[model samples]
Target: MLYHGPMAVYNELIGQGSLKEDDFQRTIIETLQDLHDRLMKYNPEPIVRDGKVAPEKERGFFSKLSKVFNKKEEERLAKEAEVARRAAIPKGLYLYGSVGTGKTMLMDLFYSSLERTDKKRVHFHNFMLQLHGRLHKLKTTTHQHEDPIPFLADSLAMESRILCLDEFQVTDIADAMLLRRLLEELVVVRGVVLVTTSNRHPTELYKNGIQRESFLPGIGVLEENCIVKCLDGGIDYRREKKTFFHSAKPKDRSKLASSSTMPTIVQDSSTILPDTLVDEKRFFWPLGPDTKKEIEMYFKSIRNGFQVTERRMNFLGRELVLPHTAGPIAMCSFDELCAKSLSAADYLTLAESFKVLILTGIPKLKPTTLHRNETRRLITLIDALYESQVKLICSADGPISEIFGGGSGAHSIDEDPSTMGQLTPAQRQMMDDLGLNDVSQVKKSPIFSGEEEKFAVQRAESRLIEMQGPGWGM
Candidate 1:
């Protein structure tokens, strides 16, 4: 195979494990290429600069250039020479762009192709989290002189010569402060080439924060030590959605829908009969401008007989399991589930208890975002799910991660708006003006019993009689 670019040669070597680094770099590059191919297929518009799908203007130029470069012997010598030159180079490459522009894809490709003999790729968020965990371990340890960061560095340095980080955003105050020193020790002092992708331009990184100026020199060092490329297609790749979701079977859809039986109101309480089951094939239903109370009522009714799955599969091929079960019932609205704001623990508990969590109505959460608190909770949630091996089924406007941008406690959330941050006065005001903020401002007086009303009337009459004529109630 005649591999063309520097990346191609690197990939070829790396794939064979003949490269000096380990598989981390090779994996990263392959992941990037995978992401690019996935995006081009799933997204309605272009994100990657498809060399095959070049503009009309460039085709003629390429045709003429191809004729000039048709010497097989010369090309072979040139490719070898170019590979040698790149291998000897000590510097790295920098990719920066807006979110979803495939900077990550490019970087991943680059990282994957490199010899796994000495490469590493990590998400900035994950890297910091690991570092923090190490720090925590060191702090609790009995050894007083042991440095956590140095311990981490020792591990990192053990088998990697090239490091690649995705979403190189520095927003955490503590991370920002320590980042300069960490990179210095890892890349500068250790001579490991560093590669990264960022949403913000390097000059604008760590912008307008406490002592941000201090990080500028480090940014300068990065600028000086790398080949920076800004692939600005001036297109919002994220806005395009070729498909709402993956091709799902009916079983998959049913797995996400509410399984509860519709409960009937008896006197003051809602009760679901044991025999009731809801047969809702469609997993999601959109709600109009609905109130929280309405959502609550809906939740109450559905949970009554809540045995959609259990009832449906009452018997196996030859065995009878719930032989007394009758028929399927109506589904309860999921409006309440999405409306009720939950604590991290509660959400986690709920996730553990239920096989399905149907979130109906316009999902208030954008998959692309999580608040700082949400990010932390979500990361914990993801970790918990991974450990528990639980699958998440979300029916939303888009993909779960994309809808809420991969938020961060490590990277500045500002770089990714889907990240958790306090809303500004202006933003809050906008929401308030639109009536989106005060969702519960409107209310109706509680409906009272006829007997209760009569009791109040009788009490008022008795009090009036006592005040007017103390002698008798004729």
Candidate 2:
């Protein structure tokens, strides 16, 4: 019996009783197992290790001549195998489900089981950013007139024949339009396979938006090229822990002053206290048991002016240098933290690095202003902080509900020119790379503007409210 790939791993995990069994997950695993078997049969080089050709025996001249002919025959056989493998294109899988349905987990298992080297797994957003960058380069440099989609697809195929994309979504209209052509070229032309996970079904993607009709072709291509599997499960395993972090009710100012320790000044006047001291009152808010008045009094107790040493740390393959970090607390501007291409992994790193984080200047995430990337990053950051039990103190433009409002109106980029002006250089570069010529045309229709994102923002908003509760950080 030849058991390989995800099924084997699944079986092993089952035997160990490490994972609970799910019918949907098992179906996906079985499908992946079948694909793995076919890939092994067609692309035998990955499954079988070939030994070095044996040294020619020092015999007669005929023996030496035979070795040369044998070498040529072997080369021909290898070429034939390569051609056969290329002909056997694998049908990719697209797993879709609600949040925490084990789509990412299953995809990861399948990805790990693959033996091929020409495979890659990436977040869909990051992948799009890269694709746009490549497209921009192509447009500027070598191929101005030629269709760039096919070229980009061909380039991607060359780099990664099997692309395992997570959290696949088509939010931006530009991305939606490009995705159709890119998918068609990759699947129909280049024979590159795609295994992706999304919260919505193919038909439901890009649901309602300006010029959404143009995006339907991409949906058709996805349906034709990939096997769409829905992972059915109800429980959000991540939410099992109700109290992941401490919380406390607001207390009297006098009580707060007595209970909280005064900041101790080090011998060096420039050196701030190691734990949870904020230099700027405007940048920090004392949530939970500590009131603003209490915090101010504590600061006044420390006679010497204080400064914190900046430090740098690496997380998720990105270098983050903090301007202020002492003991278990760090502070930075919201844009400085989130304006760049930071992922959940970077947020996780921040959570691990600090007990409390003081973020300043969080703008309202209104539909009108529609700082999509920045808003998304904030949501991810909050999720990370909440899960990791990190306390958050921050200044925002408005209350949670007002900032992350729920409405059905379309979010136009042109609604707030001032907000657009505030976009970091990196954000501007991304827009430029994506060839976003007209903001008016890129309106996010109420229907197709991503319910998942809205839900995520709502969750983040709820978390923010919870963090401010008297019980928070207790």
Candidate 3:
């Protein structure tokens, strides 16, 4: 068989009508192809930490004699070789852009084109979870003075010299602190190639984090090591109605994915719920007074009531009791699932127990600090359902998009003093001249002001759209 690279694969996909042509994606793909070519010829070198001596390599007769005869000179030669090796290491890409710009798709293409087996691809969240798990184990066995980074980095780099991560983000301080040293060890010391994607730039990572000043040095280390590029101003390709998503059957599980490959959303229209979403089969919305009763009817319609009873499931030493339950079908409220302090694990357990879930009373969560936690939990729930191939039926505040920030956060900015200060004098004058000041003259986003919240909301919207298929249950 002839070897086909990512460029060929991308073009093939476009030709097959699986993808549409976009100049932005093309340019990014070209760069990735170059990196792929570089990776094919690349060879791994031994890890060499700063101020620490590198492990000696086997030498020939003359070189081994020199090591015994002139220990100092041999050490000097070793240091020089290490420096050269570091310089020769390939600089991987750090692609940053808004959601739905095909970053992950391009990454997948690159990954698929790779002929090597040493590379490992993972989601950023799962990677962090694994990292934290390793750290926990190391902490238990090792002393406080012993740093766990070296062991962890070595283990990871040994498995994957080329690490391709999607949705790279930092939400907390511990990750913010640990990531810097971890990257330094893996990329700088171990010569690992990091090909990662994010919605934020290197500077924008953990922008709202506590004690963020300490994390800046890590940013410097990351920037100095990788080729950082922005893949923005492109359409969100996620909203496009691929037949694979809209037409799958519940029994045809092979035709479906365990989870949504949702990364970006794009349509000729920007509205969250397009006409396509109206009266969707698996996903229903627009919470009215009768919405609850309607979903209940649909639930009972799935099967004539067969001894419905609620039960508690054991999870991580705690019991989570779900209400309104049958054998493979369960029912709960949005507040019960999301409004309460439930976790992704809890949602996963819920998904595993039921083939179909009916949830009610989802609200229009305004994009603010207050709604951040609920929105995050909702996203987690959706992810678990999609991952388990569990079907979800629900009635909500509006369409999936309108669930957060109520579709648009547009309001009158002229009346608010804080908002007026944000506009230039000329801009304000123009608004006044057009009599638009009284209207939505200044359309500020009613969504999250923070990047983290915005990213999560967008993710939820995209996934919710795809989950409305017949093959939602496995």
Candidate 4:
């Protein structure tokens, strides 16, 4: 008999037919494994790493924090401070690419394989919300003049030696402004290693924002510290076959919800099929009562309809109500998700509250005139789910490609070589060399009214199609 040990790496899962092997994914996984090994035996020497904020304060909170992270220098010279720092405190990994390029899967696999209980993984938006909440609480309770960041960093560093943050995008001005300071405090002052994933490159982050120049330093800091690598799997990994490992237990009903519009998964383990194995399409088109009925039937067939109603969620001093939710599943309408004043934080909360979201009535969202705000909100909501690996069930007005209102480019995930037929071979080669995710990243002029919104729709389109893949949600 073949000795099959416990699955750890992507290649192992690939050998078991549960994962598709990709070189890019393998490269990142190797880095993660290395990081894991180092962290298992590594202990940070008590010394402050150099940061932008080299305070001159000699006493009190700053002094205490300085003491906690302080290291002895060879001399007063800055060169000596640089030389005296301990053998690199294990650089963290930052993986970014187009949607459904196996970034999250790789991160999850790495996270699962880690034996360290000190490690914590979180979606970036939710993590920032938590930080903001902590900051706020400290501000209200602590000394007015005292800075909260030092205390916070010490607390966080104590909690986790390694922080694995997922879906690292810089959209919020508050987050953008605060990011560098917070990172300096954590990574430099207190020594918390960061493993992050993103769709946007660090340099491309917060592009075309109000006072964007201010955000540049944070991006620089991110690039300088983290080993930023792009994992472009060429094709959306979602389209691959979903398989159950006989070695592992069967996935919950929610994981079976690979797509919001997926075929109803047969409950019996033996009969369960991957996306390619089934003839039925994931999305329902040309909305009607029959479509609604079909969706309801799926709800019932999957796990009998909603087990509870109006599940209240409180986070960051806000209460969000999930209208109809069963265990690991929630049924939500377009209006509830997109039409309201829901922030990215709220969507993240919703994603965490349930493993599967049944999203209904997805009308055609245009970059130009129609439902721009709704389009933006829906895009954000999809991101939250996609990043969190939540299974999304979408009932829509159109196909995934055409969802952003039919235009010259239907937001085809730019990874497909056939999509760029017009580009010369050398130009394509240059693009590949440069690691451009898609045509959307290359546009010189706005194709529609909103350049940013246009980019967002393209990303959303990519994610929606990727979510339909059999390999998703699992």
Candidate 5:
């Protein structure tokens, strides 16, 4: 079975008879066997196994399939030519793909299969982050260098013949400039096999609106110098058959809501706390169960209507209302929510305002573990809100905490002193105040216990320094 990012794609592929079995691991093993069989005919000599074919003819199909991905016809020919050239004079390979389409997995398998003398794989994000830190150090003190890119590129070029980069998209201009120079100096001049994966289509990268066109010459260099391919498989290869995984679960009707443009008095049928008079001018309703219900109902209406907007959460219930920047903003507009593109800053800001946040789609991450990291980040965001005295209400297929709880990246209680030192004072206080100082407390409160105090102290120090501004880190 070939797995892609989406579980539905996997099911679709199985329905189409593209995959022989349902199990992802079994499918991977079978796929590797097929790839090895095909590649051996082309190499004759063991290109993979040090010029000697395996004695046992082991079925390592998945490994090879990952190594050599498919591209369009023209690009496929170009890649083949590049491969041939690299055989004579070994260089780097760059493997790239859309998000969650197995680009990293392929490279990982390839790196493992190669002899220790032959190859190495390094995730580009980790590599670049380290490089940036090193460069920061190099910039200070006595190590002023004329050509930082060349200096850094030379070091990376010499270290490994095969370099596989996961999540190889760049939105930062500083990174763009440095990456262009470093890749040119390392891959083209020094000969490094560069394998990368991205969420973007090749032509769409740095698309039309970007300022630095010169730095984007790397794309042309790739076109002229290497093979670039798209894994246009209909199947989503990431979803294994054994597990029932879906991108998102259906929303609950209990959370649905309704509202009108004019002033409206809403009253709870059972309890007579007060008749809430919703100010017509304000687009957002005050935090209430009815408001949440209204938002939910509105989402159902919009999804049914098929409307879309650039806004993350659309105010379908009213116009002339304050465009809410915070609070329990609900959605009746399905298309807008689904099509929304959120930035980290935006997310942080939204988190600051609202007690509860609901997102439908499950993001696909390479190595699979990063998904959990993001989940933790979201949970941290929730905790950030909880500190400000907010309640989080969410519904999912299972409990939100249990969804991906068992994975390697799952949040585990740490009893070690090291974990305690990592926390901020504010976080520690919040945890302790909420009785979240123990492992049991963590289950009750979103805050990390005891450990948060140190982190809080560090943050305070940093904030104080930042108030001075510019020269703070310096």
Candidate 6:
């Protein structure tokens, strides 16, 4: 009950029977609605047509002069209004809760209710990826000594005064470092309001990360700049009973049934076969050549079923082949999918192609030997799939936490130099930029390698856990 305000839109929805009346959702919505109002108040620029002021229709020169004077006065008032709005911009809302608790639904409603066109609603991972790309571009194109974060933040502020980020978390040091700076610029300097949702509170974020002390400042910034509220929507909405249908007869009936006389079977017939005539549990047929052949063919076909099918496609000016896909599901090893040079566009295509993804052979991602590129790829893939509502079924060496934890060095980077060397040129450049030349160095500077990856893995782990629940994609 920390949030209290006139939630007009939320109340309207409850009255119209669109949203179920829940205290948790209502409080969060009321807070978000209030933030939305403040954001609108802070940005009072009216829409202009064709990027030019319309001339008055009056023919008199005096009228034109009067119109010009009025325009100047309006401009001054607008400037004053902007200054006042900046000072009065309400603290943004950070809604945290368990999975399927209507956090996203409320955020969506709040985002839609806002009148400002210069606002963005995106998953946090994707936003960080874009920011990283922009930083890289600025670093390569611009001269040294000019930090790109402020410039990038200014560009984003120009585009969107409010950022409604879903699943705000920090697992990676790179992202944590960048995020700390980015949030400072966006909130303090650019006056960009943030409305984000997360599963963890500010104090609990990146709890046991490597060099977590360095990342703790972002938590302070978040708590200071945003109103943190938890939505205790007890039950996960995605949890539902799944209906399963099983086959009545086995595909290889001869192995489990009597083969003396074949009974004529009719589709949809309800007649039960007599137990005395043929024992349902006894096997009478020997393993002949035909039966052996059938079994071999079955296993052989399954082995060859998911052949690596590739289609060349262009993503962000880089030519890459689409990963092997089969119907509404795709199966690939973690290395195959994440080790290669893939981008958000590729993941988007995969999400469009497959409703379910089965990724196997996911080694434990320890902070000591973290696969930076693979971890980043997995993060991007999860962001794309989560946004597209694709169900993920991954088989890792351990649970989500252990796989991405700092305790075990089971899958340390030192275990495989070939895998470490698989980083794309861009990724290698990024690592070099962070001053990480070898695994030993990365181990020493956990902040450089583990921070962003840790945060990203945490998010991916959360989404994976949520996808396993009953009503995930529904």
Q: Give the range of the ten consecutive residues with the poorest summed lDDT in model 2.
A: 248-257
What is the Cα-based lDDT of residue 460 in candidate 5?
Answer: 23
Q: What lDDT tens digits, residue by residue, belong to model 2 across residues 1-474?
A: 876788887776656544556677788888888777765654322211121245765788897788687997889999997666556777788888765555766777777777888888876756876788799988988788776776677678777777888778776677887887888777766667788988789997877655679888888877876888888677543332331112110111111211122222322333333333333232233233454444444434432344456889886467888976655567677788878888766776788677667776676665434466787788878866765546577766555555554422234434555654344454446557766545444333432234546656645655675455332332
* Off by more than 4 A, model 3: 46-72, 142-145, 242-280, 297-312, 324-331, 348-357, 369-372, 383-392, 407-449, 466-474
Best by lDDT: 3
- In what order do the candidates fall by TM-score, top score first? 3, 4, 2, 6, 1, 5
- Candidate scoring better on TM-score of 4 and 5: 4
TM-score (C-alpha) between model 1 and the true structure: 0.43
Better of 1 and 6 by lDDT: 6
Tens digit per residue, CA lDDT, model 4, 418-456 = 643354454356457755546544333232225556556
- Scored by TM-score, the top model is 3
TM-score of 5: 0.38
TM-score of each: 0.43, 0.57, 0.73, 0.71, 0.38, 0.56
Compare candidates 1 and 3 on TM-score and give the better one: 3
Give per-residue lDDT, candidate 2, residue 18.
Answer: 44
lDDT of 2: 0.62
The lDDT of each candidate is 0.42, 0.62, 0.68, 0.65, 0.39, 0.61
Candidate 1 regions exceeding 4 Å error are 4-89, 139-143, 146-148, 241-285, 288-474
Candidate that beats the other on lDDT, 2 or 5, i.e. the better one: 2
lDDT of 3 by residue, 141-239 (tens): 853457778888877887889998877888766788889789888888888999988878999887755557788888987798788988985565456
Number of clashes found in candidate 2: 12
Residue by residue across 140-218, what tens digits does model 6's lDDT show?
8862467777677767777787788888877667787788778877786667778888878888786665467877767
lDDT by residue (198-232, candidate 5, tens digit) is: 54555545443224476677765555444555543
Better of 1 and 2 by TM-score: 2
